[model samples]
Target: MDMEILKVDRLSFRYPEEDRATLDELSFTVKEGEFVVLCGPSGGGKTTLLRHLKRELAPVGTMDGSILYRGLPLAELAPETAAAEIGMVFQNPEAQIVMDTVWHELAFSMENLGLPPAVMRSRLAEICGLFGLEPLLYKPVHELSGGQKQLLNLASVLLLQPRVLLLDEPTSQLDPVAAREFIQLLHRLNEELSMTVIISEHRLEEVFPLADQVLLLSRGALQAAGGPREIVGRLGAGQAPAQLAYLPAASRLFLGLAPQAAAPPPGASPLTVREGKAWLRGLPAAGAGPAAAPHSAATAQPGAAARAGEAALLRCRELTFRYAKDGAEVLKKLTLSLYPGELLAIMGGNGAGKSTLLQLMAGLAKPQRGKVELGRDIHTGYLAQNPLLYFSQDTVAAELAQMAEYAGLSGEEAQREIARLLDIFQLQAVIDNHPHDISGGQQQQTALAMVLLLKPDILLLDEPTKGLDPEAKERFASTLQLLREQGVSIVLVTHDVEFAAEYASRCALLFDGAITAEGSPGDFFGSNYFYTTAVNRMVREWLPQVLTVKEAIQQWPDSGSRS
Candidate 1:
């Protein structure tokens, strides 16, 4: 068998208006029956490379070199033929789905390709069974959870029975459980069907262990490519300086004080929590040095003016909302209060109404019952889960300029702020580009910048880190910390439990339309059930109160000061 099912030979691509190539001399290959994961920071050409694999590059771009499928040059093949053999599941499911219902969406692709009714029906059933999507067959696309939509996208593509599957960050929008399930299904497809899978993703801990091959891309170039062990070993050696350092949180915590403590043995490698735990258990405990220091919680002095005034920044009383008359209530008799200088995270399963709750809080949707009251002096800012919806203007700069006008900033000040945001997000060159033309992460940053400029007393964000790479997520977290220090009250809904555990002051778990638990981040994440970070889970067995690395570090005796 040909080892290379798909190959890029010194491929280079550049948009017409861009001075530099978006992808320059990038080359890689995916073998039959192999699972490959392509990872890198945003705007590093992972998406561009995937687009090239599917032959979906725009006419304004120029391509150099060749892409071959089964030793046949892909550029020479008809578009339909290429698409039929090379199935693609896009980052945004809504962009590719054309039909209303899930059943129609699954069947539409095969029907358009002229498959017979019998073949289509059999294929659909097989795909649904393979992905555990049988129950979602008749549901409308809009009604499905973010994860379900991703699964539907995959199922729709699987109906074609393509030789190679190309997934572009398919699980980025899913909750933790749903994301894990999706990855497991993908593994089954690769094992049972021997389908070649090429996925670009940021959730490394979820996908890395399952990947047969891992490729790292940086600055639109292929920086490294090899099997998972080889690539990760090179990363551990600090060879890929430009790539984001995304060690397992557990490993990072221990390695911080004991730099060489958690390094894998000569021939052994561990990437996920389970593997790391096994590795940790095998090693004898480092001789207990000093007793851990006593816990000292910080306390704020009275009459120290709070970030925002004493006024209630955001409040909800008996909030209730339902999707339809017959549908189950999503937010049932929920009441909450948020003050300035507080960072609160709402977490739950995919269908637990986290996004719905955020929309209601942001005043984007009306509650079916009860009341949501904003303080008289409070201004509200919102960052949506799908930031693309916030873009009405054409260019990135234009969007910020419009937001500046609304915020009563002078043109010069608006320009300065826009430049500052663009610099921080590393989107300086793309400021004049259309929002739709940029990557999803860049668009998210732009939306966030616009929201921050509003400087509202309360900010509402829905999955702000959904599609971002690890580096971007870290940067966004730091930015949120700065905002909190400035007296902004943040109410964010996300599936990123680790982020919540690290950054949030308080956390609320939503289930069946109501909050089942609420408390300080430590208390909420320390619980075994509900949404909790991996680090929290790891240390829960050892230290119950440790919810974050910072907290764990502080628990150590030698640590100097707490942040």
Candidate 2:
């Protein structure tokens, strides 16, 4: 049996100003070489708990707990020994990076450890090769795409050869392909190097299958801890807490389609897309649902008929954009139209210029050719990818008030709107806290609330789902649906394929600086392989139209139990 790497015993903590504890008597143990996944709803103390494990970054707060690393108290360990033995990668790639160039960032940590030049060079070469960072070794960190930046951050952390790696939503900003690749790298490290990993994330679709152990938390308390299959069984039996909604698409489909009493016997829950497909094939058909059809690009215009008579709220015709006079074009001859009340999702790889297109549409940046046209008297609001760009006030409440004033609302109207937003975001507890002091997800919610205050007829959001937990994402989707009902058009540029497939009325793929594909969610995601949602990938052979867990449950036989 593997030895215990870290042990937490009856841990509880609270910030200085808060009355209630942020982390309550949490007890858990992680074995060496284990891939542990820690997850829960937003603001549930995941970040706080991770921080406490790393002595240097632990938050200053009232605490009563003991964290032991390899049988030694983490607090009593020497600073250099702790730093070299344990490594942490933050949620925001930009937050943990310190140097200007990729090579410098990798060297910074080793230099502080006073390692010899030969040893540093040897370790750097090994890590760069392992992470495929050799080509980008000399590149300035700012010029790298989100995926590259995140990869570089991970490579930097691994250079020290830490025994245990802790990552806090490390792929929150990466594209789907990149996120999958990152997760695979984590798996490789755990299996080959025997490097223990503790990751806290909301994107459970990919990581759930790779986890050796799963830890679920809620409001700073450990709700469940077990094998991934065991947790899925709990979710199926309705025995798991609500925070366990982070279940992968496969497990979700199995639980939903399987009968209440048929929770799939012990640890037999389907955990992967392939396993899900096999399980689905073995199921008895209820009514012979629609036959799966081969998807083709010809289905691109399926949504055009729905918007036939309505005028586009915003249109970009043959738009071209580039950041510099001699640089390559970011968006070339891109033409798109957004109908009123429609939510259009634009997805692509890390550097495919999705954010640039949103900026051009929002009039924050100009196109070198063609033009962007908006309906007469139309108002537009844009939420930047970086939430910090929109915040000016110290506290979230003050920021919301400032936004309300800017929207020309005052007194009772402003108060009512502010109160509603606070409740919807579940941000009332942190209303008086500084936006920067809160968690990344909370900052994202605060930014979104501020954007809504402007009351624009057209809203442009860039990666609006980043850093959000499952429950928060559901709330955001519902809010988006409500906004659409009120005739507010939205353009979302995101790498979150699942969110786009389920919530966006239409989806478009941007590739090689141009729109390569566009269609309704069913037509677009259903036709995709790697770029589609987990459910679509799982059931594409039997039900090509399914893009979400709910859709799969509805289409497949839900009552029968296969013996």
Show where candidate 1 strays beyond 4 Å. 57-59, 78-80, 130-135, 239-244, 250-266, 286-311, 547-563
What would the per-residue lDDT of candidate 2 be over residues 201-220, giving only the tens digit for each residue?
99988898899999988888
- Displacement of residue 285 (Cα, Å) in model 2 is 1.5
Q: Considering every candidate listed, which one attains the maximal lDDT? A: 2
TM-score top scorer? 2
Per-model TM-score, in order, reads 0.90, 0.95
lDDT of 1 by residue, 1-563 (tens): 64889888898989768888888997777788999998888888888888888875433588898889888888788878787888889887778878999999999988888999999988888878777778778888888877678788888887777888989989877888888888888898899989888999877767787888888887788888887766655665663333525545554554443435345344355556676556544544422333322332221111112323565577788899888889778889987767678888887888788888888888889998898888787888988777888899989888988998999999798888777777777778788888887887888899999888888888899888877887888888888887788878899888887788788887777778887667777656665443566665554544555766567556543444322
Worst 10 residues of 2 by lDDT: 554-563
lDDT of each: 0.76, 0.87
The parts of candidate 2 lying over 4 Å away from their true place are: 239-241, 260-264, 286-289, 301-310, 557-563
RMSD of each: 4.5, 2.2
